[model samples]
Target: MGSPSDPARHLLDLARSRPPTLGDGRLVCIDGPAGSGKTTLAASLAALAGAPVVHMDDLYDGWDGLPRVTDQLDGLLLPLTEGAAGSYRRYDWVLQEYVEAVTVAPAPLLVLEGVGAGSLAHAARCTVLAWVEAPDALRLQRGLTRDGPQVEQHWRRWMRAEAEHFADQRTRDRADVIVDGTAAAPPRSPGRVT
Candidate 1:
């Protein structure tokens, strides 16, 4: 195995030379707990492959809109699997309305990023599934900071739900690649804290 510096190269090589265990169609999913940097990694991978990404954030309808996400993913992102124009209705969080129609054309590789990006619910169509795993304490701190105090209650509830979802779904365990998203400090000494 190689080092973690170039994930896209790693994935591409895996896709190209993989044995018959993995299937075809070039779709990769990067899933994880919130704030695990799935989006950042997916963007990097997409750029490396000269592929486009189908961001799940664009499909979500905020805290109350999750149930509708699967529909959007099916309608918008999945079409790209066949090199079609992907189109879906996006929800406007601020105005609290279903906003505009966004369209994207499929490519050789497509990076799907977000929670449940690799869930069994979505995996039947994915060629590769990658999970970015981070410690819960670290992830919660990052998510809380990003979400801010105004949405403290919302964040807390979402975190609980996410925990439950991961437990039931086993998304990380089923991943083809596991990414470590801890802070960029040297590997901690066995007995040290920081």
Candidate 2:
């Protein structure tokens, strides 16, 4: 692969190709701390790959749910590798509980985006794992801005969970691609394939 200045397009190419380094069907994980740009990258890649995405925030039980959500992510995705529809319950943060079970039809490529999406519990099963990281200060500001005043306290708590989870998982060292989330993606027409 050429050194792609646009990290998102590069990742989109990776997803479209389904590189052999990955096992069977695509299980791509975009992981990083909150506001590290995992969501943005995932969206760009998903658009290019014509893939459905699973956001870890929807699976999280709460601010301290980082470690707990990996199992659920694994359960939701593992079935797809064997040609079954993936399903899971979405946890509502405001309600502080799981609300609905979402069904994701099996596809050639599946994207999981958010903090802890690449946790060790299921990283081995992923076809491709991408780590998007940004400066802590910038990430914190992005998070606070996105989440707004309501989540200021929750953001602090999630920050602690992010540190502990990343430390335990050693996610960066193991990633197949390291993306500088701060950089803007160059424009490219999406050639998504089913």
Candidate 3:
């Protein structure tokens, strides 16, 4: 078993090559700020891995739900990690409530993308974790554009929550790979955190 030397083909390839005992033990995490290209990267990896992808946005209770969301995710992923089907209620941003709990079947690889996806507890159970980052200005710009102008105020609140979560969880510090979202093209090489 050798490490993947190329980052061009697919992140899935690199991730699947690493293991933590189980043959199908792989949880690919794409954690980063809003508009940092986590969704795009997760989609690409999912295409290559044929794995199910779940977003943190759907699980968050609200704009300032980062702390709570981590607990929710931890509860959901715990059972799923041990080859058990688990369920979670997706928070409806428009309605501002959890509608129903969606059932998630056990799979070899699950792509979890969004802020706090690769949190300390989650990362400990993951086979490969990727932490994505981009310039603050670019991230804010992308968030404003993607989420619409109405969310500017919410974005500010969310940023504060994100800061607290990251500082405490140390998600980026423990990542197996660091992805630079600012690159015009998908990163050709994994990054190193300063």
Give TM-scores for every candidate, taking all chains together and pairing residue i with residue i: 0.80, 0.86, 0.87
| Candidate 2 lDDT score relative to the true structure | 0.76
In candidate 1, stretches whose alpha carbon ends up further than 4 angstroms from where it belongs are: 1-4, 18-25, 183-194
Alpha carbon lDDT of each predicted model: 0.67, 0.76, 0.74
User: Compared with the true structure, what per-residue lDDT tens digits does model 3 show for residues 41-158?
Assistant: 7887787678898888989898877878767786678778777776778889889999888877778888888998877766566666687788877888899998898899899788
In candidate 3, which residue pairs clash? none
RMSD of each: 6.1, 5.3, 3.2
Model 2 per-residue lDDT tens digits across residues 1-194: 33477666666566566653223467788888888888888888788777888898898888877767867876787777567777888999779999999988777777889888777777556766788878888998998788787788888888887888888888776677877778764323233211
The best-first sequence of candidates by TM-score reads: 3, 2, 1
Root-mean-square deviation of Cα positions for candidate 3 versus the true structure, in angstroms? 3.2
**Ranking under lDDT, best-scoring first?**
2, 3, 1
Runs of candidate 2 with Cα error greater than 4 angstroms are 16-24, 184-194
Give lDDT tens digits, candidate 1, residues 11-94.
666555543211224678888888777877788788878877877766777875554577887776556655577787877767
